[model samples]
Target: MTRPRLSAVSVLTFSALIILTGCFGPPAPAPTSTSAAPTTTAAPTTSPAARPTGVTSAPAAPLSTAAAPPSSAPASPPPTEEPVPGGLPEQVAPLIIYYVAVEDNGVSGPLIGCGDSLVATTTAPVRFTDQVRPSIEALLANKSRGVGLSGLVNVLYQSNLSYAGGELTGSTITINLTGQFMLGGVCDIPRAKAQLEYTAMAAAGATSAQVFVNGRPIDEVLSLT
Candidate 1:
């Protein structure tokens, strides 16, 4: 009796499902969460004993331990003086020099002035000055050589002549002599006087001479001789 109830509706529904599967297969499989290719970051480089502390070095000081010295100025020089015009007076002492004179020509009637020829070695280089004493010393020593020099060949001789000192004025020199120095004989006195005068004036660069014996001027002795 139920076999007679079968219908087309149920059969059609089953056929529609079959047709959807044939047209489009089952949905694609769900996508899985896969890891990306590993990243390749470079590691940061660092100096030994230095890192994220970020500490830095300090600047060095210009000078070490030592300090500089203080400055000072130099000293000043001394002042000087200018010299006088024509220079100073000349005076040289204790020198060796010739005692100069002229030889006399007369034997009698008293000799007058000195002549030209010299008794060259009658006196040696002796300590000289522009003074009378030194001159007298030299003259006497030469006279002491006897006969051929200050003394006469036969008629006279000059002995024991002595000079004290002298003073120079203008072109003349006044010489002081000892009294006994002029106590010589007549003819010899004049010649001796000539020698004394010439030597002294020559040394002093003077042209005339005046004599004083024992503080007495020899004008009379000169007149007598």
Candidate 2:
């Protein structure tokens, strides 16, 4: 018998068949992969009080708004002093008296007797006539007869008069005179008793005459004599 002809094709065919059979065999039971059952971790437990609530906290109370204390008011200004009259002292009162007679030719006689007195709250009556009379006589002597008479009468009516000597006080003045007068060149009894009251108030050191006639207010008749 001739040895079976070993052809290259037949040899190759048998080898291939073996290789395929091995490859098709069920894949070796997949390696039993039991990844140690993932280690089970226990969740942390919380008490009911620890649970987070959705509510937010309220704001604190507002600060008090009490007003600041008020500032004190400024003090008032001091009162102003009044200006004193001219030709007079700062604090003095005057009293004056005049005596005159009408001449035959309608002229006025010289100032015969003149006097001044003063009364202060804490002191006795002060008579300044000796010092005051001469000055008053000089004033009368210088004036014309008509003016002198008028001026004398004016002086009598107006009580308060301040001159070189001092001041006089009291709201009223009394005059008693006994003299001869001539209306139209005839001698006549010019005796008169007159009482003068000051209606207008006089300042402490006023020099001018500021009095009224008998029972008459100063405003009614301001005639100088």
Candidate 3:
């Protein structure tokens, strides 16, 4: 039998057809998807309460009291006067007057012509000069005769005479003549006695003489006993 002769080209084409048939023989399987929903998880719950701090409360207020009132200043006192003895004007007057007389005249010798009968003597003559002695003698004579004159003379003499201690209030005068006696021997007893007599006489010459206590005058405060 006469078969068709195959050319080189036909042989190549046949080999190619065999390779394509084998390559396209089978296909791979397709993938599949399911229609399902996604799931969500819930968070933990916390309490809504507030916490306390270190210092919880505040301090309480203090109590109150009433205040005191202010005070006023005090008043000043009045000036004071010197003190004089009271009562028994008669006794004090005579004593004070007599002492004043003795001191003013500088009496040294014994008292004479004073109490009763008015006669006195001394160891020596009066010491004061003639002019001064007579005046002093006059004072003594006047005192022996009257109380008013005696008081006045005492005041006057005391003013002129030097003394240690003395004070005068109203008509009343207190005199300390004891120290005067110490001055004796400087003048003779006669002269001293004469001076004493004269001073007493002068005190007796006053008309307005009075004894007082507490700034008030008293009657008969002085009298010869």
Question: Which 10 successive residues of model 3 have the least lDDT summed?
Answer: 216-225
Flag regions of model 3 displaced more than 4 Å: 1-65, 71-161, 167-225
Please list all clashing residue pairs in model 1, or write none if there are none: none
**How far does residue 137 in candidate 3 sit from its true spot (Å)?**
14
Q: What is the TM-score of candidate 3?
A: 0.16
Best-to-worst order by lDDT is 1, 3, 2
Clashes of each: 0, 6, 26
Where model 1 places Cα greater than 4 Å from the true spot, the runs are 1-122, 128-132, 142-161, 182-184, 221-225
Output the number of the lDDT-best candidate. Answer: 1
The stretch of ten residues in a row with the least summed lDDT in candidate 1 is 95-104
In model 3, the number of clashes is: 26
lDDT tens digits, residues 1-225, model 1?
556754699778889999998899888887667846555543344653553344333345677667756557665666767766572344545422232233544433223544422232233344433445665565555543244444433112244446777888999988887745433454455555666666667666689988887777776656655
The digit string of per-residue lDDT tens for model 3 on 1-225 reads 999999999999999989988999756655546635454433322532332333233344766665655547664668778888663233112211232333333353234333212222221233332222233333333323223433312222321223222233444333222212222232223333334433333333432323222232222211110
Kindly provide the TM-score of model 2 when superposed on the true structure, using C-alpha atoms: 0.18
